[model samples]
Target: MSEEVAPHTHFQYADARHQAETALSGMWLFLASEVLFFGGLIVAWTFCRHWQPAGFDAGSRETVLWIGTVNLFLLISSSFVYSSGLAFMEAGNAKRLIQCCVATMAIGSLFLLLKFYEWHIDISEHLFPAGPFKINGADAGGARMFWSFYFVATALHAAHMIVGVGLVGWIALQARRGAFADGWLTPVEVIGLYWSFVDIVWIVLYPIIYLVGRE
Candidate 1:
């Protein structure tokens, strides 16, 4: 009989290792579903772009390139920070883990702030698809479609970042409470997976939203 190694190990888990594996597996399954959801959106966007190449190009040009680039770096940094925290937790350094979690949360929040600012700029430039669109040409309709996808994809990605920030905050609190001091870092690892997924989604969006048609 495998001895349960952690105080928080549930009854269903035979041991700490069992619990950690199950937790990671569950997170991966959840991420798979998320991939499909986002994948569909990407596919739909690709088809729309094919149908209205000029409009999509025009819409892409309207994006604030610097802002999107900065946000991409921020999200990538947050993922790195969170991974560092996880590494610290594995090394039995709870304090450093907490610090990393806090840092990750701060970075994620900054990304959200910048994203909102970018959206504000976009709206000011009449980029919103519903109201008065800024692009004027035969490709105006396609450009409007491009803006529509931009808003939807970016907005959805931002929403995921919001959730990720909250999760990081929670993990930080847990570390402060010594939840993973005994080396049972399952929760941290699980949340790390989620945070990484959010970062990846943004990575995919950054190019599609800001770079594709620029050349």
Candidate 2:
């Protein structure tokens, strides 16, 4: 029950607290699973790169550094959209809240499409990690390793982008329903948490995979 709720109210204090706790606890558990998924990739990458440092370094050098940098900035800007959305939701401004979600989705779509182009260019240049590679030398194998992780991590991140678009759609629906008037903004808050978590993962990936071995 709400604190200001009347004595005759059907909802009780324990129920309200339980609901809040359950929401936060669920988010935390999901985050823990995300950590394990990415953490395992990082570990595998570390061992492989360590075993073939020269090849890994060469692969990293071949990366289009500027593109990675630009994408990082793009994603960072999208995080601001989430921040603004959270603010608008709390303030009960339905227009601004929906606007923020749409803005974030637009930016995210741009990021993913640009990423697709980047991957295409790499493939055209024979930078892929597997069979029929045209790049000369043993570094080909190493280059393949880098591309392997590149595809895996970025593809995983792109999946999150799809999920974000869905969240924005749902939020648009809620805003249309006039739900925030009741201060029922918890769903918005939870989706924001998930979106930001994905953003944070990319922030870490950007430096390690793109910038770490720069000349």
Candidate 3:
């Protein structure tokens, strides 16, 4: 129990600590469910790779490594910046929070741009598994499966990034208006959690999608 304050913006609970705990718990629950969903994709990837290691490796080699590497750098850095925004919020520095949020969104958008560019390169190279895939021979099917998994996983990740960008922008707008001061920092904290989750998924994906076949 703590001193009761008037109902804040998002949290109706008067106890500040209770509100923080509730928000954190809710975010963890949501992220846990997301982890389960992504876990299925990883399981599928494992099975497919086990079945056709050569094909999987071959498909991995065809991917443009540099772009993926760059995107990973951008996303990881953006998450760090977003974390700083959360720190700023905790310190009651709305100005820094807004700046960090905007920077996070910009970096995330750059990652998405680079990702799409790589996808475009993939298309140009005829790596897309659109039935008549260029990855010919007996191992072609396995290679196609690998590419399919790659597309699905990356697409889902990009969608999540897009949503994160929007959320950061919204938080920035709110912060600009002084809406997040006086202990109303739940939104910043929870959104940073989400952004960090997305970055972690990409961290896992980067090695799987880029490093596996190189060896």
Clashes of each: 1, 2, 0
Off by over 4 Å in 2: 1-14
lDDT of 1 by residue, 1-215 (tens): 45444587877878878888999999999999999999999999999999889889988999999999999999898899999988878889999999999899899999999999999999999999997779887979999999989999989998898898898999999999988878788899999999999999999988999999999
TM-score for model 1?
0.96
What lDDT would each prediction earn against the true structure? 0.91, 0.79, 0.89
List TM-scores for all candidates, in order.
0.96, 0.89, 0.94
Candidate 3 weakest lDDT stretch, 10 residues? 1-10
Give the best candidate by lDDT. Answer: 1
Q: How accurate is candidate 2 locally (lDDT)?
A: 0.79
Candidate 2 C-alpha lDDT tens digits along 45-77:
888988877778788887777777888888889
Q: Pull out the clashing pairs in model 2.
A: 1-12, 129-144
Query: Could you arrange the candidates by TM-score from highest to lowest?
Result: 1, 3, 2
Instruction: List pairs with backbone clashes in candidate 3.
Output: none
Between candidates 1 and 3, the one scoring higher on TM-score is: 1
